[model samples]
Target: MTSPAELLALYDSQQRLVVPEHPPAGVTFEVTDGVMRVTGRGEGFVETTQHLGLSGGELDALIAKHRDHFAARGEAVEWKTRAHDLPADIPQRLERTGFEAQEKEAVLVGHTSDLLVARPLPAGVVIRETNDHNDIVGLSTMLSEVWNDDLSWLIEQLEAQLAAAPELTVLFVAEAEGTIVSGARIEFTPGSDFAGLWGGSTAPAWQGKGIYGALAAARAQRAQQRGVRFLQVDASPESSPILQRRGFVEITSTTPYIWSPSAPLGTQS
Candidate 1:
């Protein structure tokens, strides 16, 4: 069992390393006055803020810079803020600077051993790990239906990521009658003992049937096999309690402040 403090420390350290201040291929990264800005093809984000002591005017200017940068590329940008981030007023600043605050999520952490308990899947449901394109498309489509949002971008991103670094990413899906009902992906942090769980989605009809727990268990087993130490997730309120029952602890909260070119500065709507 890993202590919360230890898990948090691992998270902080691994985050800085895995999520680099520099841009990866096909993305742009810029750092100004200790604020790191990243812009991809369809989205952008602000992170790695070092000088949280900046005045309101400076913060506003920083936000505008990122907005214009992403707008040039016709991309919507998100400023991801964690509760433990410094200066303590960053979230308020982002809200005041035309960034609409999105849903708040619990950052859950747990040891792989704690989540690897054997659980029987629902009758006729089986979990499979795959890097195949068709399987990825099925999983993405299921998630799109689950969240009621277009997740085609997810398919593109997953295909590219798996092709570029197969060892760093794994896709898992729960299938019934050869159709994906629940799906999730795990990403391993190179040179770190942390693996992140993302896109945990189950069909509405499949909810409360222990399908998610089984999916999580499968990922945990894979993580243990890879010698990973900790598993982390940004869990929604609905999923937080379920994760808690599996030994995951809420270490902090994270919220995304989004800015679009169409929206006026200092206004959410």
Candidate 2:
């Protein structure tokens, strides 16, 4: 049995603070003072190691560097922080530096074999894997309907991921009566033991009908096929409990602290 601590250790060792060896076109990766900064594509992201051995002043300077990096390009940046990360005050530091905290999410991990078990789907609903541009666009449309926000970024991101590494990314959708009701994806980490199962968005009428869990299982099955050992999800509050019930171990919490130039230092918006 894989303990939560063991899984978390594995996650932190392999997934945390990674540099993109083959960054997709228009993207650049930089590592400075234990932080990996990803820039381009109109948005930036910053990730740091679990143990950032820095004094308060050093950490503050590092945070300011992140701010300046994005501010120069006039683009927003999302600083990814995990609950167990050190200096132990990184989230507060981000906020004091004008980063707005987004929704906190549960970091869930489970063995691929554990989630590979077949699950029941709603009547007449079928989970299908897709790589077509049309299906990708349709999935973004259906997801926007569920979240009531334009998910145009999803389409571009998915397409970019697929084009960058077709073998590493796949899209899935749940269709009922020929209409898309749910969407999901699996992204295999090229050199890691984990595959990310992400984006389970279901129609309001389709929620709680087992579509979410079914989509998860489908993606897990894909992970198993890829010889991945574990599946991971940064689950929203609404989906966290559901993923927990499906055998994923709750490891830690994560929140994205976003900052843009319009929101200057010492303020959040």
lDDT (CA) per prediction: 0.79, 0.84
Evaluated against the true structure, the overall lDDT of model 1 is 0.79
Steric clash count of candidate 2: 0
lDDT of 1 at 136: 85
- Best-performing candidate as measured by TM-score: 2
Off by over 4 Å in 1: 20-25, 29-34, 49-53, 267-269
Each prediction's number of clashing residue pairs: 0, 0
Candidate maximizing lDDT: 2
Tell me each candidate's TM-score.
Answer: 0.90, 0.93
In Å, residue 112's CA in model 2 sits off its true spot by: 1.1
